[model samples]
Target: MTGAPRIALITGATQGLGLALAEGLAQRLAPDDTVYLTGRDLDRVNHAVESLPGGGARVRGELLDVADPHAAGRLAGRLAARHGGVDVVFGNAVMRVGPDDDPREIVTEYAEVNNFGTTRLLRAFAPLLRDGGRLVVVASSLGTLHYLAPILHDRFDGATSLDEVDAQVAAWRDAVADGSARGGPWPGFVNIPSKIGQVAAVRAFARERRGHDLAHGVLVAAVCPGMMNTPTSAEWWDVRGAPGPAEAAVPLLDLALGPVDPLHYGRLVRNGKVLPWSPYRDDSA
Candidate 1:
C-alpha cells in the first residue's frame, strides 16, 4: 500500500506462521502486487493459495524445499526473470528435531534446512532485492547469543562474513558426527545452534551488503516471532494456550511491509524491538 506494486516471497507457507505471513502480505499488498507462497508439497501450496482472501488472483503458490541446496537458487532465477527483482523476502522455512530423533539425522537435517537454508536464501535472493527492499529471516528466541555458553558467543557475534558463519556450522556438524559435541560449549538442544546459525547468517549477510552500492539500501532483520500454537510447535512442546500463527504474524507483517529503521538492520528483532545479544534476564518470555 505504501510502495509501488511489490513482489514478495514466503517460503514454507502452506501452513502455520508461514501461511499467516503469506496471508498478511497478500492482504496488505496492492491488488497488482504479487505474493508468492512456497512449500514443498504442490497440493498444500495450491491449497494455501486457494485459501487466501482474494481468490488467488495475486497470490501464487510454488513448490519449494529449502533443504534442497539448489531449490532456492532455481526459484530465485524464475522470480528474477518474471519480476526483475523482489521487494520483500521472508525466509520462513524451518525444520524441528525431537528428542527421540536420531542425533546424526538431526545434525544433517538441521544443517541443511535451518542453518544453510538461510544461507542459500541470502545468497540467491539478496542480490535480487529491489531498492528499498526488505529481507526477514524468521529465526527463534533460542537463537540469542546467551542461549549458548559464553565461550561460544564470539563465534556467532564475531562472524563478519557468510563464509565465516558457514565455517562455524560445518565445524559444529563435524563435531556432532565425531561425538565431541556433547561436552562442548554448544547447547544440548540441537535446534538452538541451528537457529543461531540462521540469525548469524542474516547478520553476516547484512554486514557484507553494507559496503555495496545499492540504491536506497536493503533492510535485513532476523525476527523471533515468539512461540505459537502451530503444528511445528506441537511437535516439540506443549502449546495449550499459546497465540495462534495469525496473532504471532502481526509483528512479522509490520517488519515485512511497514516502515524500516536503520537501527534494526542486521539485528535480531521481536515485537518491533531489537533483541539484545545477551540480556540480564530471559527476554524470550
Candidate 2:
C-alpha cells in the first residue's frame, strides 16, 4: 500500500485453487503488499476474502468474470488507475461442464472461458506489471499431452513467431465453430485444447515481451497445477490421483512469487519445475 511491495490479482478466487492461492499469497505478503481475489459472484468473492486465515487485512475481493472481455478491460483500467500497475497477474479462471455435454458446446465454452478469457486478461494486465514483474496462467499438463489436430499441433510446436500461434488459435476456433474440430482423442473434453491454446499464448507473450526494449523485465509463463481435486474436477479426481486444492496451490504461488529467471520464461511448469513441451499420449483406458 505504501511502497511497491508487489500487488497480485487472481481470477476465480471464490473457491478451489484460486482461493487457496490467495490464502498462500496472503500469508507470504509483506505489510505493504496486496492481493486482489476475484470471481463472478461478488458475495462469494467477499466471503472468500473474509475466510482467509486471520481475515488477511491486505487481501481484498472484487467481481471479475474473465468470460466477459469488457469486464476484464474495465477491471484492468481501474487497477492501473488505483495501483499504477500490478506486480503479478494470475489468469486462473476456467470452466469445465458435464463430461457428457456435446463436443461442440464444450469446445465453444472452453475457448471462451479458458483460452480467450486468458488472452483478454493478458492483453489488459501485461502492461500494468512492473518491468521485473511476472505473469502466470494456471495451465494443465493435458495441454501438452493432447492435440486438437495434428496439423495444428505441428504449427503450435514449431511456431516461429507469436503471430503464427495466434493465427493457429483463431483457425482452431473457427474449426470448432464450423463443427470441424471433432474426432480428436479429447472430444467433448474441451479443457485439453483450451489449455493447449493457453500454453501457446504464454509462449507468444513471452517472446513478444522479451523482444521489446522495456524498462525492467516481464516474465510470462503458465503452470500446470496438476489434477486438483475440487468441484470442477470431481469427475476425474479419483482416477487421476488428484491432490487437494491447497496442496496444488503451493507450486502456483511459488511460481507467481518467485524471482524472475530467463529459463522459466515461456515454459510450462509443475511444482515449481519446468516441464518439457511434449505430445506423449496415454492410450490406456
Local distance difference test scores for all models = 0.84, 0.75
lDDT string, candidate 2, 7-36, tens digits: 889998888888888888888777678899
Q: Candidate 2, after superposition: displacement of residue 172 in Å?
A: 2.6
Clashes of 2: 1
Candidate 1 regions exceeding 4 Å error are: 1-4, 55-57, 211-217, 279-285
Q: Which stretches of candidate 2 lie over 4 Å from their true place?
A: 1-3, 55-57, 145-149, 158-167, 183-188, 211-217, 237-241, 279-285
Report the lDDT of model 2 for residue 38.
96
